[model samples]
Structures are given as C-alpha cells and as structure tokens.
Target: MQALKEAQKTVVSNAPSAIFPANLDVEYVISFRYANGGQPAQTGDSSTPEEQLEKLLHTLDLAGLRTVVRDGGDGTLLIFTRIRSEKKLLGEIYRSRVRDWLHGIRPAAPEKETQQSIEKEPLTDGERLRLVYSLITLPNSEGGAGITPKQGEWNLVQSIFALHDHDFNKKWLKDWSTKWLIGPEDLKVIRDRFGEKIAFYFAFIQWYFIALTVPAAIGLFAYLFLPAYSSFFAICNCLWSVLFVEYWKRQEIDLAVQWGVRHCSTVQRKRAEFQFDAEATDPVTGEKIRYFPAYRRLMRQLIQVPFALVAATCLAAIIAGVFSIEIFLVEVYNGPLKMILKFLPTVLLSVFIPIVSTILTNFATRLTEFENYENQDSYEAALTQKIFILNFITGYFPLFLTAFVYVPFGEILVPYLDVLNVTVQHFGHDEKYTTSDTGFQINPSRLKAQMIYFVVTAQVVGFVLETILPQVKRTVFKKAKEFDSRRKGIDTQTVLDPPEEKKFLERVRHESELEVYDVTVDLREMCMQVSIFKRWEV
Candidate 1:
C-alpha cells in the first residue's frame, strides 16, 4: 500500500503539462502489468519493470509518437500516446490517400499541393486513429513502432487500444436510438468515427433490414390470403433473393466509392508474424520485399481439409448424441425423475458445445498462424472462414436434424432410442423404459419452436447479454473500485491529477481499462444471421 502511494506520487510528478494541445490528444493507450512480487519476469529476460517501461517509451519516441506514463492502479501502467508531429502525421495521411487514388480505391486524386489539400479536407478522427494504430503495431520494417502487445519481446504489454470519445458516443447512440432508419449522413458519421470496416458493417445491416421488408410483407400476405405451400410465394421469394443480391453488389460498390476506400485491401501492410522464405524487389518501386512460396503455403493450407473434417465429425457426433438423448427423454422415456431429467440434455449441450467450440476455435487460430499469410487481411480472412465453418455446424446442424431427420423419419429413430432407455434402466435400476409402450408421436411443432427460438428469442437474449450486461457489469465494478479506493485512503483526487486536469486524465484512465471493440465479431454475427435466415426460408 505504501509502495502504491509512492507510485501515485511519482505519476503525478511526471504528469505532462496542463495545457494539452489538440496534437497531443490521447488517441491510443498501451497497458502492461508491473512485474512485482509473485509475478514472474519474462523468461530469459531479467530486466526490471522500470527498465522495460523505459525501453518501451524509447521505442515509442523513436516511432514519432508522444507518450505520457501514468499509474493505471492495481499494479498496471498506462502509456497515453498521440502523434508527436502533426506535420509528419498529415504527410503520412496524404501519402496514404494518394496511394489509394493510384490504386483506384479513391475516385479522385489528392491535390498536388499536399499540405494545402490536407488542410482543406483534414483527417477524420477515424483516419487519424487508423494511421496511429498502424504506426504503433506495424513491424519496424514497415516504419511502425514494432510493439506487438502480448507477443514476442512485448510479452508484458497487455493491450493497445484507442480512447473512445464519450461525448460523441452519447450523441451517436442517442441519434441512432431516435431514428427508425439511418441515412447517408449517419453512415458518413460512422465512417468518420469508426473507419470504413465498421461503417461497411452498418451499411450492410441497414441494406439487409430494408431488403427484408419486401419479403416480410409478401410472407404476411401469403399467410393471410394464399393457400398452404403456395408456389407463387416461393417463386416471388426466390426472385426477390436474386434481385437483392444483385442490387446489393452495386450498393456495395457505390458505398466503397463514396467512402474512398474501394480496393483498399490491395494496400494492406505485411503481417509482423509472416515468415518469408525469400526476398524480392518490387518491379515498379524497386523496394525490397519479402516473399513466401505459393506452393509451400498451398501445402500448409491442405492441412485445413483434415482439420475441418475432424472438427465437423466431432461437433456432429456431440450434437447428434445430445439430440438423441433429448428425444428419448422428452418423447420416449417414462422413468423416475422424468421431468427433471428432461433438462439434462440441455445442460449437457450448454456445457459441452462451448468447451468443444473453444478448443476448435483455438486449433483453427493455430492453423491460421501456421499457414502464415503475408498480410493481416489475408490472415484474418482465412481465420474468419475457418470460424464461420465452426459456427455453421454448431448453429444449424441441430436445426437441420430437427427439420429433416427428426420430423421425416422420427418413428424409425424413436424405437432405436430404446437402447438409451435400457442403458439408463440398467444403471439406475428404474422400471423398463421403452418407446414401444410410450405411444410416442413426433411433434411437428418442435421444428417451428426451435426456429423461433433461434430467430427471435436468441437474438433478443444475445442483445441483452452483449449490450446491457456489459454496461451493468462495468458500473458495478467501477463503484466497487471507488469504494475500495476510499477504504484504502488512496485520495485519487489529489494523487492522480491536479484540479485543472483531473477530469481529462481520469477520462483517459477510464478509457484505458475499457475493452477494445473488434468489428470482426459484429461482422461474424451479421453473417450468421443471414445464414440462419436463408436456411429458415429454405
């Protein structure tokens, strides 16, 4: 506790000046735990925590980022960072825009007077944050600080994340909540704040929501006015789907052009983890570049075939076993504790699927790393594909079984569940439980119930878990922290910041602890929703 107080005093003494300039705005934070008692030092590297911190600061300085260190509380340190030279950052942004123009990513070329043009348009918050992230995380060879958090030399570096603008976030959320449908300006705001990757996700979701309206109305009409299994409805559904896909392609292109990020995938930086087998010079730029043989990568990628097979087989077997047990309990069994036992399959499924999925996801990640794509985009794309496969199996396989196998050929399968009943009877010395005497009848409504659960119930539960629960947890944790601080007589009011700068510094510290938002997770969820909708329609 005494050491912590001293550390707080040291932080206050070293805090940057009161008048923080716009150029010095804290865009990113690098956090790491202190290597104190009971915390083992990085293996084979015996540097003390202060020495490691100094080295990291030196690296950031060399990378042209201004950094200020603060005590992050609870044995952690936070390094707040921004571009040191506004002029240099502007030049980098200008060069990036020019490259985009040259590659046909941007519709218009940047003006020849670079600085003047940059001043005219200025860098959006998203553009600045993206470039700063690249500066910090890209390899040294790519002109970045070469600090890969939680990897290699920076093993103690826990995270690197950007600070969120609370004011902007409040306004943005309120605006979105108030609007029934987001317009072009809303999308432009998203692009300026969160970059094109995240903006594209919202754009796709909005497009999908609007397109769904037509089919929804048609389905309603069919339900009210048409005969069961109407051919006209089916034909119209198919046609609408075809037209939606075709038009979305054009919409995607237009959004890309408007955002000035079309064809931006071509300009990806080399992955720091990429291993090169050879070196080559670019034909146009004559710059030395790393090369990995296509055939070698192809051989490594072949391993994915066996991996996918194993993953599918394992997950399918589990789901099938659970599904069978559930069927026997619900529809066939007439044993002791029958009502309570019916929930056992759900419990087993809830426990096992996540454990298995996590194991498979980790394996997929390792496999992706083994494949060693040259760029970040390619690496992420490969991993996303593998994960999507896993998601598809876990998400849809049970539904498929219920719809096709259970409903169509359930009579044959239910009698076979007698084997499970016999096994249970043998173990527990219960009465003979067999489907032959139970007068079992398959519930056709089961499939519809499961569909509704996935389409509506699961989505609502997921939203509450993803959005509401996190906020609640954060609030509780924060209040507890404050209470603990008060109990300890830490006096954060005085030790952490001067009166003039307290609010800003405290905001930075709070933002430092917040989780880094990954747009990929949201994108994956959207993809899963689309896949589920298509399967349900079929």
Candidate 2:
C-alpha cells in the first residue's frame, strides 16, 4: 500500500501540466489490489479490491484532486481526476516539454511521461491541437492511456459524457449567419465535447455549405443575366449537383481518417438484436461473438436491387399519372369546376404517398434484417441508403418528369391526351373539342417557378412537419390522457406527504421523460437534409 501510494504521489507530483490540458485531464485505470483484500485470491498483490479502492480514494484526496470512480463490474475501477488548466497555458507547457525532450532533458518523472520526446515543435494552433489530440489518442505504451469504452486493460470503460456546451452551439448558430466559415478548432471543440460521429456530420455539413457557395453564386448570376440560355444553366446545375455528391463521398473518407475512425466500423460490436447461426472466437482477442457468413449476407443484400426496382416502378407510375392529370386539366380542358378537378391528383397523392412510403420502408427494414449487419452503424447506413433511394424517387421524380419529359416534349405529348377528341360527339356539343394546331403552350418559366417554391415554401413546410408536428401530436396525446384521467377521477399527481417517496417518484418521472428515438429517425433526418440540398441544387 505504501509503495503504491508513494508511486501515485510521484506520478501526480511530477506530472507536468504541459503533457495534458487542464480541462482535458487524463483518466487513469487504477487496477491494483487493496491491502484489505476483497478481491479474489491472487498470488502477486497483497492488497484486496476494497483496500485498493480505499487507497485510491485516499491518494486522490491527498493530492487535492476530485475523482470520479466507475465500477467496471469485474473488480476493475475506472477513475477520472479533476485537474484542468487554461488552453494557452497547456500550449506553453507542451512547447516547454518539446524543448526539454529535444535537448535530452526529462521534462517530468518517467512515470509521468506520456509521449516520447519529439525534436520537431508544433508551429501553428492547428498543429498544436493535432499534437495534443494525437497524444491523447495514443496507447499506454506510447504514453497515453487511450482509455475509452471497450479499449485497453480496462476495456469495459463506462461512457463519461461531459455536459454539452449549449452556449457554444448557440454562439455558432449566431455566427453562422454572418461569418459563413466553420473552422477546424470549432469542429475540434465539438469532437472533444461530443463524439466524433456527430463532429464528422458537422464537419461534412460545413464542407458542403462552403462547396455549394461557388455554384449557387454562378447559377444565380446566369439565371438573372442570361435568361435565353436556360438550358446552359440547367446542365451546369446538374453537373454541380453530381460533383457535390461525389465530393462529399471523398470528404467522408478524409474526415474519417482525421477523426481516427477510418476502420472503426471493423472493431464495432454486433448489435444485441442481431441473430447468428453460430459463435466464434476472435483470433486475436479470444472474445466469443455471434458469427454469420459474409457470402450469405451478400446474397441476402442482392434482394434489395429487385425491391428498389419495384419501388421505383410504382413511384414512377404514380408520378406519371399525377403529372398527366395535371397537364390535361391545366392546358387542354376548359370546363366547370376546373380548379377543383385539377387538385384531385394532388389530393390523392397526399393521401396515398404516406401509405406507399410506409409500406416500402417496412419492406426495406425486413431486407436490412435479412442482410444481418453486425453493428448498428452498418445497419443504419444500409437502411439509410435504401430509404434515400425511395425518398429520392418520390421527392424528385415529379420535378424530373416536368423538366425532361413534359417541358421538352409537351408539344407532342399533350396532343395525345386528346385521343378522346374522337368521342367528343357523346357530349352532345356537336362542335368537336379537338386539340388546336398550337397544342399546349408549355412555359419553361414554370420550371424555375417550381424550383423557387420547392426551395423556399416546401422547406418551411418540411421543417414544420419534421419538428413541430411531432411535438404537437405529443401534446395532444398527453392532454387527451389527462382529460380521460380526470373523467375517471384518477389523480395523476403524486402526493408529496412523504418526502422520500416523493423524491423517489420524481426521480422515476424524470428518468421516464428522457426519451431515446430510434436510430433510423436520426439517419432519416440526415438523408433528408442531403436530399433537400440536392433538390436545391437541381
């Protein structure tokens, strides 16, 4: 106990504040046995688990550091000590350590040295951040504990999430309106506070917005000044849209590398709901995990291609019927209740689109299940890809029909709708309602108008649907429940006569209010955002 305590003192005392940022302190895995011996019999260490835990608490208390302890369930303890310094001070400390390391002088005690002495000094703030981040990511052999959930000797590390910096997010939103620039430091702050997955999304969004500015400016200029050359702008817009999607794919790869999650998917554990035919041991780690054959999964995935084709055919047929009805009513027909009849297709679409989408989504879910992805990330990614395809067809195919088929060839196509011209005698009008030689005057300006509506009006509607509608539904449901309870004379409110019971019930209520949405919802939002951007580009 004395030796371990002495070692702990040495480590804490000699630890230079330069090696780790004050606010971003290093977490340690204190695994030694306690002297009182609550641990299972081990030949080497004299201490018990309880004794070790007490010693750890005593040592931390003596050092005047606040420690958070997590029980690892297998006689292991995870500790996070409170020690922080200003960012500027940390930079200076790192620089000093670099100098000492280069000159063959030890900056701190051997036990406190986390990184090897480097001859090269980090020059810029970005480089310094990288150096610090790299140090933090290294393994214990390389001077960093690299302590994370499912990593290192303390592999079952509990997740320790810091409180979100809502202030920073608010400031970022305010700044984004005027600044139009999101720096790496801002992304780093997010990555440090949140996980890398979320940070990657923010980075990608920022990158996408910056990339979009050039095309948007050019497209707007062409649209205003070169009205006669509309096709030129349309072609350029399509090309730019394609380029953005392709660029984002590569950008994802780059960000994955920067975030050190390039092959992180490979290390991810299988989802708890996943089923397997057999179990196998990992060759390197000797851990038992459920196993499924890759070939069989691939064969299962081939089923999605046929499903996608079927969905696309159904969607295309619906879009075509809706577009044809719209054209016939708007241009060819001159009859009573014209405006009301024109909305028939739209009303039908509004009613049926959701039904079709839900059916297709359920089918996609089944396909994904059959594919049997090992991890949640992989499962979500595959499912999101399938959903994006469906959303793309339903959301954009109508516009595509208007752009490519209707506008370009409307002169020939609208006349075909007059196949009923021969049967006009049945109406008893005697004067035939045959189509005129001029056919329908298809205005190209309508496409631009539709694009404008989609960009501005549709997005506002979508936002209300995505965010406000759910809350509205929830509020209505809760109110209805309350009304029913009142009618039954059931008191929903807890009586607070007993303080202990009240506190316990209140804790339970608070926990109940914390909701976790299905992963698919988050991925769907991301997919929809991408689709919205693509629509704007088109």
The residue-by-residue lDDT of candidate 2 on 1-538, one tens digit each, is: 1222332333323333232232233322233221111325332356444554565455444433345553322233445443222333244346545444444443332312222222222222233333333333333323332433332232333332221233555776787667667777877756654456567777776876687686778777886887654777768877777888788889888776665456555444345345578978889988776778899998999998899999999888887887787777667765545668777876777667767888999899878977988776798889988988888887788778888898889988887886655554356453334334456788777676667656676667667766787678667876886787678665555333245334423333332222333545654555665565555444
Question: How many residue pairs clash (N, CA or C atoms closer than 3 angstroms) in each of the candidate models, in the order given?
Answer: 0, 9
* Top-lDDT structure, candidate number: 1
Per-model TM against the reference: 0.85, 0.58
The per-residue C-alpha lDDT of model 1 at residue 140 equals 80
Any runs in candidate 1 off by more than 4 Å, and if so which? 1-24, 36-40, 43-48, 282-284, 335-341, 423-438, 468-510
Model 2 regions more than 4 Å off: 1-180, 227-258, 281-289, 294-299, 302-306, 336-351, 408-439, 487-491, 494-538
lDDT of each: 0.77, 0.57
The candidate 1 region of ten consecutive residues with least summed lDDT is 10-19
Candidate 1 residue lDDT tens string, 437-507: 64779887788677777788778866976789778978898788678877876543425555655666667
Q: Report the Cα lDDT for candidate 1.
A: 0.77
- Candidate 2 local Cα displacement, residue 408, angstroms: 5.3
Candidate that would win on TM-score: 1
- Residue pairs with colliding backbones in model 2 are 22-84, 22-85, 34-47, 34-48, 34-51, 34-52, 35-47, 37-48, 114-143
